[model samples]
Target: MPPTLKKSDFHYDLPPELIAQAPLPERSASRLLVVPPAPAAFDDRGVRDLPALLQPGDLLVFNDTRVIPARLFGRKATGGRVEILIERLLGSHEAKAQLGVSKSPRPGTRVVLDAGGEFEVLGREGEFYLLRLLGEEPLEKLLLRAGRLPLPPYIQREAGADDAERYQTVYAKQVGAVAAPTAGLHFDEALLDALRARGVEFGHITLHVGAGTFQPVRAETVEEHRMHSEWLNVGAELVEQVRRTRARGGRVVAVGTTVVRALESAVRDGELQPFAGETRIFIFPGYRIRSIDALITNFHLPESTLLMLVSAFAGRERILAAYRHAVAQRYRFFSYGDAMLLFPGRES
Candidate 1:
C-alpha cells in the first residue's frame, strides 16, 4: 500500500522570532541555501552567486506580475473601520476583495476610504466581497493614491516608505498581483545583468499572487487541501523560449512557485502551450514536475503548500532537513527572508 500522507507529516518547528519583519537594505544581499537532489547535502551561498551556480544556456523563468497597492483602509457607514484587500480586479471600477471589519456590511453599504473616496459593497464571491468603487477615476489610480502595500501579516508592522520599492521585484512589469513573488525579490538590476552576462537566458510569465497564499492549511490530509485560483499568463514567446532551451540541452530554472505553477499549467496533453487563465493547481509530494528543472524560492511556512511544492521537486525528507539547518543557523524566514536554490531529483 502507498504511504498515507497527512498534513502533519510536513510540519516543522519554527520560532516566531525567525520570521523576517523587514527586507534587507540590498535586494541581493540575502543568503542562498543550495539544496541538490543528494539527501542531507546543501551549500550555504549568497544570492550574488546565482549566475555562477547556473549553466550558460539555462533558462531562468521569472514572474513579472507587479504587486498592486491592494490593502485599503476605510470606514463603514456606521463608523466601523474596515480593511479591504483586493483579491482580483474585475474592471476599472470593480474588484473582488476580502473585507475585515467588526461586523459584516450588508449589500449596498458604502465604505468611506481614508484617502477621500468610497466603495459600495455589491455582494459576495465566496468569502470575498464584490465591490464597486464610487468614483470617476480608474481603480488603478485610486489604489495608487489610497491603497497601502499589503505586506505579509507576519511582518508585524504597518507598511513603511521603503516597502514601496523593497517589497517589489526589480523586473516586475505586469501590474496585477496583490503579493510580490518573494523569490524574485532577491534579484536586483545588477544581478539580472550579471545573469545575462553569464549567458543565462530569461523567460517571463505572469501569475498575480493572491492574498490567499498566506492562508493556513486546515485540512487533515495534504490531498484534501484546495488551492486558491490565481491568474496566470504564459505567452507564446515564453513557450518558444522553453522549447528552444530544452532543444539545446539547457535547464529551465523557475524563479518562484508562481512561475512553476504557470509553466506547468500551460503544459497539457504532454506538451507546453500558451495559456492565459486562472489556475488552482495544488502541488505536493508524489507529484511529478514536468516544466521546471530547478527552482529559486524563499523559505515557506511549515505545512504550507509552497513547502510541499519544493518537497515535490526534491524529496520531502531532504527539504525538511534543509529547513532545520536553515533554522539552526539563524537564516531568515518568509517573504522578506533569504532564498533557496533547489535542483530537481532524478525521478521528479
Candidate 2:
C-alpha cells in the first residue's frame, strides 16, 4: 500500500451524460478499452473483440454471483413510507438492511411491506438495521416475490422491465449479489461460446457484490477507510484451474474486481487456496498484486474503491490516463457502462 494514500489521488472528471442509463441492445455490442501495462495509447475496441485481445490457455475467471432483487417498498407504524434495501440475509427470516425512511425507527418498531409480509426492527448493525420477519416465510423467497431490482444510484431512473434481465450477466448462477458484476455483463452466451471455442478457459468464483460497492470513500486518507465485507467463495475447482493455468504458463484473467478480490483474498497467506467467507480485503496503490495476470473490468466512479483497486493493479497514473481517455472518447461509465481489459503494471 502507498505510505500516504489520499482519497483525492484517484479522482477523475466524467461527463454525466456518459453514465449509461441502460444496457446496449446486445451485451457484447458495447465497447472495450484495452489498456496495456506500459504507457502507450490504449486500444479502443469493442467487447466482441475479446478473442483478439486474449489468447488460448489463458483462464478467464468470472464472478458467478447473481444480482438479487433486493429493493422493497413499505411503511412504518406511523404510515410513513420507507424503502428497504436488503444488504445481506442473516437467515431465512432475518436480514440486515438500510432503511430509507425520513426518521430512523427504534428497535422493535414494526414495518409493513407494501408487497407482502411485515418485519420488526431488531436493532442496529453498523450502517444497517437488523430486521426479523414477523412470519416464518423465508425472507429470500419473499424478496424474490416482492423485492424490486436495486439499480445503481447513478442511473437516475426506476428499473424498467428490461432491466430485470439486462442488469444481470448471462452466466449468473449463484444468487446473492445486490449489484451486477458489470464487466461480466459484456459477455453474453454467444460471446462466452466464442471465447471457449477460441481455446479460452473459464473458472468461476462467487463474490456477492453488495450495495456498499457504490459507497464513496469519505476518509481524507485512503488507508483510514475500511471496506464493507462481502461474502465470497473460491471453491476447490477454481483453485485447481488457477494452478493448472500457472503451470501451463497461461494468464489468469479476472473478469471483474469482485473476482480479483476473491482470488487475492484467497491467496492472503502467499498462495492460492480454497476459501469461503466474508472478505473486506482492500487493494490500493503500492500493493503487490500476485493473483491475476490481467483484469477485465468496467469504468468505475472517480475516487471509488474499485478505481483504487484497479490503480493498484495497473499504475495509478496509467489508470487515470485511461480514464481521461475514456471520458474524452465519451465512453459510458458505471454498472451499465462500457468495459476495459487491463494488463498489469510493474508491482512496486
Candidate 3:
C-alpha cells in the first residue's frame, strides 16, 4: 500500500464547463468509458453498448431507492431565508433536514415552506434540524405538494418540470432517497429489456442516499474522514443471486456506489448476508472489495467520497489517470454525466 493517504490524493483538475447541467435527449445515449482490471488502455463506448459488454450469466444489481422531492425554499418567523433539504423522514409526521439559513430557528419556531406548507422546528441535531409537520398529512405528502427535486449542488439551474421524470430511474420503487442512484439513470426500459433478453440477471438493494453525499470531505487525511450513515436493506434473495452467479462463473456488477456500499455492508463479517439497518461503510484504497466484480457508475466530483470509492475498486493512480483521460476527451462530468464500466483491479 502507499504511504498515509491524504484526501488531496483524490483531487483532480476539472473544467467547470464540463459539468453536465442537463440530461441528454435519451437516457441510454450517454457515453461509456470501459476500464479493464489490468492497468492498460481504456475503451470509449456508449451506455447502450452494455448488452455486449458482459457475458450472458453476469448478474447486474441496481439500487431501487426512489428520489423524493427534498428541496424547498422556506422562511423563519423573522423573514430570514431558509432553504430546506429533507435528509430523512423520522416518521410519518417528522423529518430531519439540512436547513440553509443565516440564523437557525430555535425549537418551537415555525417555518413556512415556499409552497405554504408549515413545519415546526423541533430542535437541532448536529448539521440537521429536526422538524414536525403542522398538518394531518404525512411528511412525504407535504414534500410532494411543496418541494422541488434536490438536484446536485453543481447543477446551476432551477428544477424544471422535465427534471421530475429525467432525474429518476424508471425502476425506482422504494421511495426514500434524496438523490437518484445516477448510474442507473443511464439504463432506460430499452436498455433493461435488451439486457434481460441477453440473459443478464437482475437484482436490487435499497440505500436512501442522504444529503451528506454532497458535503465536501473535511478531513486532511482519508483515514480521518467520517462517513455519513445511510439506511440500507440487502435481502437474502440478492445474496443467493450472487452465490449463483459465482457458481456459474459470472460476475456481479453493481449499478452505483450506493449499491456498492449496500452489498459491501451486507458482508461485514467477510460473508454475504441479509442486512437491514444504517451503514457508514467507507471504501478507500487498501480496502479489498469482495462484494462486486464490476461497477457501473457516473463520473464523480473531484475529492468526493464517490471518487474515493471508485479509486478503491480500481487502483487510485489508474482511476485518476482515467479521469484525466475523460477530461481530455471532454466527456460530461458528474451526476447527469457520462458513465464508466469498471472491472476491479488486482488488489480488489
Candidate 4:
C-alpha cells in the first residue's frame, strides 16, 4: 500500500434524472464523447465514428466474458424471501454468493428457488455465502435455468427479456461475468465489421466482472479500499498481438476497464505474458499504466474505482472536467449509457 488518496476527492454531483434507466434501441447509436490527448479537450462524436478516429493498424482489445444470469429469488426453509447473487463459481455444483435475507441463513439452511431448484449454504467466505446446489445439474445450468439477469441496482427497474441480449456484448463467448463490460455494449456486428474493414485488429480477454462492481468505496482513503478480486484470463495470442501492434507503431486500444486491468495485470512483472487468475489491482493517481495506448469506455459513477482509473489514466482534474462537461451536456450516465473514446494522456 502507498499514501492514500481521499475518496472524497473523486466525488461529483450528478443529476439523478441523467441516470439511464434503459438502453437506447440501437447500441451503436449511443453518444460518443471523444476525449483528446489533452485531457481537458472533448470532441462530440458517435460510437460509429470510432473507425475514422483510429489508424488502420491499431489493435482494439475487447473483453469477451459473458454476463450470466446470476440473480435468483428464493425462499428459505422457514419461508423467508431471499435474494442470491452469484459472486464466483467454485465448482460445477457449488458457488460463492451474496445472500440477501431478513437474517443471514445459517450453514446447512436450504433455500428453495422460485424456479423450482434448491441450494444449501455450505459456509461463509468472509461476507459471501458458500453454497452447494441441491440438485444434480451443474451450477451454470441451474443458474441459466432459474436466474434473472442481475441489472445494476441504479437502473431502478427489474430485469426484463430485452436485457438478456442488450446487457451482453454481441461478441460475448466466455460465460461468467455478472455484469456487462458496458463499453463493449455499444459495438454491434455491423460496427465491428466496419472496424475490421478499416484494418483495425481485434483481440479478446475474459474477466468475470463480479456483483461487487456496484459496491461503494467504503474506505475514506482510496488506497485503503481494496478491490474485490475478479478472475481474468489474458491469453498468449493477445500478448503477441500487443507486441506486433506496437512494433508496427499501431496503438493498443482497450475496450473497457476490464481489458485494461487484464492487460496491465499480465505485465505486472515487467513483461507481457499470458495470465489466468484473479486480480485485485487498484489503479489511481500516481500509478503507472504500462499496457494501453488508448481506451474506449463508458462514463463511470462518481467516486467509483472506475472513475479513479480514468483519472489515473488522464489526470484527475482533466477527467473531472470532462465529467462536468458530460453532465452539462446531459449525456446519459452509467451502464447502458453513452460512451467515450480516450486518447493517451500526457499524464499516462
Give per-model TM-scores: 0.97, 0.98, 0.97, 0.97
The residue-by-residue lDDT of candidate 1 on 105-184, one tens digit each, is 99999999988888999998788999999979889999998889999988899999999999999989998988999999
Q: What TM-score would you give candidate 3 relative to the actual structure? A: 0.97
Can you write out model 3's per-residue Cα lDDT over 56-169, one digit (the tens) per residue?
A: 999999999999999878888778888888999889989999988887689998888778778899999899899998878888988888878999999999889999999999
Report, for every candidate in turn, its global Cα lDDT versus the true structure: 0.92, 0.92, 0.92, 0.90
* Candidate 3 segments exceeding 4 Å error: none
Q: How many clashes in candidate 4?
A: 0
lDDT by residue for model 2 (1-348), tens:
237989999998888999999988999999999999775679999999998788999999999999889999999988999999999888788888999999999998999999879999999988999999887789889988998999999999999899999999888999888999989999988899999988999999999999999999999999889999999999999999999999999999999999999998999579999999999999998777899999999999999999999999998989999999999999999988899999987547
State how far residue 124 of model 2 sits from its true place (Å).
Answer: 0.6
Candidate 2 residue-pair clash tally: 0
lDDT of 2: 0.92
Write candidate 4's Cα lDDT for 1-348 as tens digits.
545689989989999999999999999999999888672559888999998998899999999999999999989989999999999888798999999999988999999988888899999978799999976889999888888999999999999999999999999999899999999999999999999999999999999999888888999988789888999999989999999999999999999999988888889578889999999999888887879888999999989999998888877877887888899999999998999887666763
Model 1, position 260: C-alpha lDDT score: 90
Candidates 2 and 4 compared by TM-score, better number: 2
lDDT of 3: 0.92
